[model samples]
Target: MMNVLSAQDKQRWRQDGYLVLPGFFEQAATEEMLGRARQLLDEFDVEGHPLTTFKTEADGEHVGDDYFIGSNDKIRYFLEPSSLSKPAPGAPSKLLVPPAQSINKIGHALAQLDPVFRKYTLENEKVANVAKDLGYHQSPRVLQSMIICKQPRIGGVVPSHNDSTFLYTDPPSAVGCWIALEECTPQNGCLSFLPGSHKTARVSSRFVKDPSGRGTTFESVAGVEPNEEKWDELDGWVEAACPAGTLVLIHGNVMHRSPPNPSDKSRLIYTFHMIEGAEGYTYDEKNWLQPTKDMPFPALF
Candidate 1:
């Protein structure tokens, strides 16, 4: 494995809860991945897709339908809520544009199912090395992967929250890798993060399946209640706008968000979460996402 993170980078990660590495991936690589994503979007049939709109709200509520829950090991497409229009009362919603232009994301198992995504995810040694450098000394596994297509005019907003709230594990060890497939700008809803919030913020709420097994919802973590103060009001927030191929490493507890893209262009990004898989670190069973017995989460090494 090659050396990726330096001492300065490590320090920055500890102090800021995130690190941005410009040009971490080459232009050719990003373009190839982006092209493949576009191909997949173009080929997807939305005729009978159930029209599951992907929603993540500012209040910590998220979409927890069967489609979202069952996508742990399968690649699936989700629609943008803003792009759907109601033609009549008591009727199903219809998309305003073509399927390719209306999709909000393709997610949950791209790395495991698609060879194009796998090359940059599970097969990327530089990423694995970065995990090792970040203190995944015993074992680390890729938990979830997704391609977020911030479509022009209809892309939704993602509220401020930490990744660990969605991908919880005992002792709270999860890191996020965000790769920009296209140029990200403030006008196109680039990510904004609260620096060093990881040190003060706790994973107060968790996204988990209901005990009845019908759906999922957010549950308060034991002894950690939600803060009355809003996270967005905190100081030292910084917006990250970078060119294609930039990689951003995010600590699990860092508070971050991206505004809705209302521009003429789209901002495409690929993101995956990693968790400690070593002994003594337990993955929560009630977590909305789970690995099947037939197909477990693959380790980095």
Candidate 2:
């Protein structure tokens, strides 16, 4: 059973940019979560759903009004790029298949909106202890959470990138906790990591939205350039296959990627980002997702 991070484990995380906790959550819990996930997916009403699907212009940022702009706090479905149609000029984005099989992820925020996830991430004190042991020191904030549905056959390649790039802080404090609900294996596109990358990896650009919240884009921050090619040349990237109920703690700046799942099995996983909630460190306003004023990302203490 997984417990608090030992000193050796902490050292490994500090030096290697990650630590894997096998069976951190009990098997029964994982099974329950998986069941709930499927139940929610089946229960989601999709009849002429206005925002049931979302997409970015090929190689472009997300574009929309309040209905889309405000998706940050709401539970919603985001479509994978492989499932949407490429429009020419004035045509609406078309769905290539049934909406259920095409979803990339379920959320901008599911932890606060859903009780099953809330129990695992927020109500569990052991997890809070894990976060403290990982060096958050104080109460860590559950900044963002998602149920990544690496849908069978069409799960798009998650490009080589870092968590800090997306959930950047002023001093760059972002930690990712990824849990595999299903068996994550090579055939299903398990996450690949560049070992010891946090020692030198830097936050290059961040996904952001305009102040008016019209369009989402990437803005560069003060950091190092992309060195994926160099890292690959040195054979640094390693595939991390996680079993069900395993928790993988990932540093903010470690370069990682997962290949597209071309297999018949879906690589379903639940993940969330935690950031240092202490003074002086600030989450950039430019970061696209923001919680509602009434229901801000909670403190995990």
Candidate 3:
């Protein structure tokens, strides 16, 4: 098969732990994805769980464990405070009507649930080539698909985090393909990644299911010390200002984050995470999410 990423693209990803593939997908394809994403939001009557660290300020209470463990083959919504309108003046102030746009993200796992996503992920030759080029000589396990709409004006800041901390595999294989469906700008919000931080930084902790299965918790590693000055120490971040149809490859351990969106416009993107799924590699048992017996992670190669 032909390589999806050119030699130069691979080199860029190697040197920086990330790479930007500008205009990767066609404009029509991105438009179709954006349209499908919006349509999915209209299908669900229920709002989603804001699963961010800053979710205390979100509209709903903390997300229940069932959402993470049981939503393998379903489409759900996650809200950003910006999506919903504030209570009307002089009214009860308790019931906030669904604002102009009231869904911040569409999922934590999507390809396994939706046909459109599944078709593109499993059948698209181009996508498979990218997976092959990423050193996954065997089939790649493609999971954790989401359409994140950084809503205008009130999108919260996403703190820097490592992908492997959440999706840790035995050999530590986790890579994220963040695709911009709409223009991602510094004015709205775009990802900023620290160059070459993955080599030295360690996974300090992991978000996992509690032993008793009551709720989710972060289990900290015994000896790993938090590196507060790491981002500053490594040449700082490179903001990914990409237009629609662009793809950004993010390393599993690279430190990355995005600021709150303060602009009137919105930044919409679709993201998928892949990990080595071949034998000899095991998914961490303690990780907060797992495939229910009915739905399992799919293959792409």
Considering every candidate listed, which one attains the maximal lDDT?
1
Clashing pairs in 2: none
Candidate 2 lDDT over 54-150, as tens digits, reads 4433225454445555767887766677777889898767778677777777876778888999889898877887887776546588867888888
- Against the hidden true structure, what lDDT does model 1 obtain? 0.88
Write model 1 residue lDDT over 87-178, tens digit each, in one string: 68898888889989988999899889899999998998887888878774378788789999999988888999899888888778889999
* lDDT for residue 251 in candidate 3, whole number 0-100: 91
Give residue 245's lDDT in candidate 1 (0 to 100): 97
Please list the C-alpha lDDT of all candidates, in the order they appear. Answer: 0.88, 0.78, 0.73
Across 3-57, the per-residue lDDT of candidate 3 in tens digits comes to 6887887777887888888888888888888888777766756424433222422
Q: Estimate each model's TM-score.
A: 0.96, 0.89, 0.86
Give the lowest summed-lDDT range of ten residues in model 2.
Answer: 51-60
Once fitted onto the true fold, the runs of candidate 2 whose alpha carbons sit more than 4 angstroms away are: 1-3, 50-68, 86-93, 211-213, 222-234
Candidate 2 lands at a TM-score of: 0.89
User: At residue 117, what lDDT does model 1 achieve?
Assistant: 91
